[model samples]
Target: MIDRRGFLRLGAVGGGAVFMSGLYGKAMAAAGYEDFYFVQLSDSHWGYKGPANPEAQNTLRRAVESVNALAVQPDFIVFTGDLTHTTDDAAERRRRMGEFKQIVGGLKVKDVHFLAGEHDASLDNGAAFHEFFGPSNYSFDHKGVHFIAVDNVSDPGARIGEAQLAWLKADLDKQAKDARIVVLTHRPLFDLAPKWDWATRDGEQAMALLMPYSNVTVFYGHIHQENHHMSGHIAHHAAKSLIFPLPAPGSQDKRTPLPWDPAAPGKGLGFREVEAEAKPVAYQITEFPAMKG
Candidate 1:
């Protein structure tokens, strides 16, 4: 079922590809493992009008087209967060979310997932986000992997809160200690750069609950770039933004959006394609440019 042609074509356009995995290997597939993949588009920042990205309005629409053009459509699509830029008007917020929803609705794939970012939720504790997209935090089982969508941005404090932690604990207790688990969030769980508002306040607790599990990987967004790091045994990978790119963690005093390069318009803007192999429990992540320079 692997469409080699489509995969190659996508890679040819987008470029950077990286591979990540856990300790779980071939033995994990004894129970009928199935390989699957998904698309992750983050930080679209719809309705954002700034010099950082003049193509802000068209960027997301273009990304949708890019995914639709994929030779092999992913099993599902997930928007990590920051779907819209921050707004002071609640009505404007909802309007932006509405418009964002309508645009993405053009996708060929019917099953798409969304999460909240501080811009979309922190203002009113995810009130408008809930009106458009249900439950900020939830979990699901796909093939043989357990996917947990954590809502750290819902609380303006950047904390997952005690309640969600309890829920996560309860959920983890049900799965086998060695379950292949993937945690998706808008903010990096570990402290990547606290001054930049990239770290989750109580993310350590969530990691603690997941620590007992042997196979665990996390995919998050917020910093707006491709970054790879490890917290003990857990591996955290950050996704690029569909909007604009941010400076590396602590690289500069202020976490300002990098100046748009006239030479390469879409240089730092893109999405991700994650191919999951159940047998070896590996994730082949390919980063694709939202728009070519």
Candidate 2:
């Protein structure tokens, strides 16, 4: 059995995406402390009209409503990636981003962080995305944890080139030895499957840059499902999509968007709530689905 710290170390070497297994134990360890909670919503795919999810926009709206209705207002919200679907028309892309902003207008929390997925960046290498959402990569500290948002889906898909890697190194170097680090991006840093554009091109180099950090957690949204693994002390988590869920890698011959089942309505529209606190290092993840009514 792999321990939490050991699991993160293995993720550093093996390049496998890591997630925390003993969630209950970790949460219990941090009991009786002031914990901060943030919501992660991904793959909204605004302006997408398809049979796979006939009510995509409505579903997204429902998700925003759900977040606003939370008993404990989140510290902030993070839209991991895929804010809009790809299209040849630049105006269309901007329109989609516009719609996305409008949909989240109900967000009770003020600070909302955004990242770019391949669909949002690949068309013109994120020119429009950044124009509407600001920098694709940035870093900040909240409640003693260093959070770094990286742009891994830069052209060529899932490649965190030299410049970003250097930036990441610099960012990590500035933090204290024991500060908990949380890295967020659109693609998984591990090689979930390269052929299908699921894994980052040079994720191993990125992982090595994070190896020195004692407590690190990498959160991403792309595959449109929930998955967790461990790399040393670092935990890798993939979030569910607000648009639709895709089959796990190798589970199907081709990775395609799964249609919302009338029989299983409201199945895939959900988001992950992450809580992290200082001292003793703890995290609790709760997944919430959109309200059916």
Candidate 3:
């Protein structure tokens, strides 16, 4: 349902990348807003050790350096999910989480946000993740936009669950019908590829709750590549992973990381910048390599 005008891929400007939607333009126009932008880095899988990415230990650090190199730093930065690789050992999990935090600490921007991916949360119901980061699901406001971070990974079944659904409903009830809304989650609310664990089990209910709001955009990760989709008037954009990329939805028999291309080491791994303009209600998304040439 992605409106034809909802997404415009403005690829690689001055060695960066960006995206914008028609809906964002309209919402900004109605909100009496000020221009602002944020950085989104997803699926770093910080503790991973594998051939999929030989330089796993340095990828996240490179990403941080890339952001630090931005001519104008974003107001804030957010890691959508998979901040760490999964571990059955509880102590090891905590250690990875701690180390991951310390690495991202190099960012020039002090205001950073986090969300949980299944690898970081599904094992112990987000206990380790919560211990390092704060609550997984919450809301905040900036420059006339309402942002909600929903925790679907915490439930193990990939469900937002009934309790959080009530919370979402209550939160939405407080906003104006035209409030500009941004949803950040680890999984797609719509059924992108159910067998691959890409869709939230009860995401439709969550979408129903958000549908009444006229201005809404969703940013997510878990797919490990840049994907754009529309759910009615709402636009969902998936971010690129800092670790490795996966095959496009259902393009292959199995959901596995694409082999790392030694010839192009950083090919499928990167981060993005979202710049929002107030006067015209426009936005531009710019992407950067996790490791620069």
Clashes per model (N, Cα, C within 3 A): 0, 12, 8
Q: Using alpha carbons, what is the TM-score of model 1?
A: 0.95
Off by over 4 Å in 2: 1-34
Candidate ranking (lDDT, best to worst): 1, 3, 2
Name the weakest run of 10 consecutive residues (lDDT summed) in model 3: 2-11
Which lDDT tens digits does candidate 3 get at residues 186-220?
Answer: 99999999998989999999999999887888999
Q: What is the TM-score of each candidate against the true structure?
A: 0.95, 0.87, 0.93
Per-residue lDDT over 43-131 for candidate 2, one digit per residue giving the tens place of the 0 to 100 score: 88887888778877688888888778765677889999998888889899899888888778778998999999888898788898888
* Backbone clashes in model 3: 8
Predicted structure with the largest lDDT when compared to the true one:
1
Backbone clash total, candidate 1: 0
Weakest ten-residue segment in model 1 by summed lDDT: 5-14
Q: TM-score for candidate 3, please give it.
A: 0.93
Off by over 4 Å in 1: 1-14, 25-27
**By the TM-score metric, which is better: model 1 or model 2?**
1
For residue 56, model 3's alpha carbon misses the true position, in angstroms, by 0.3
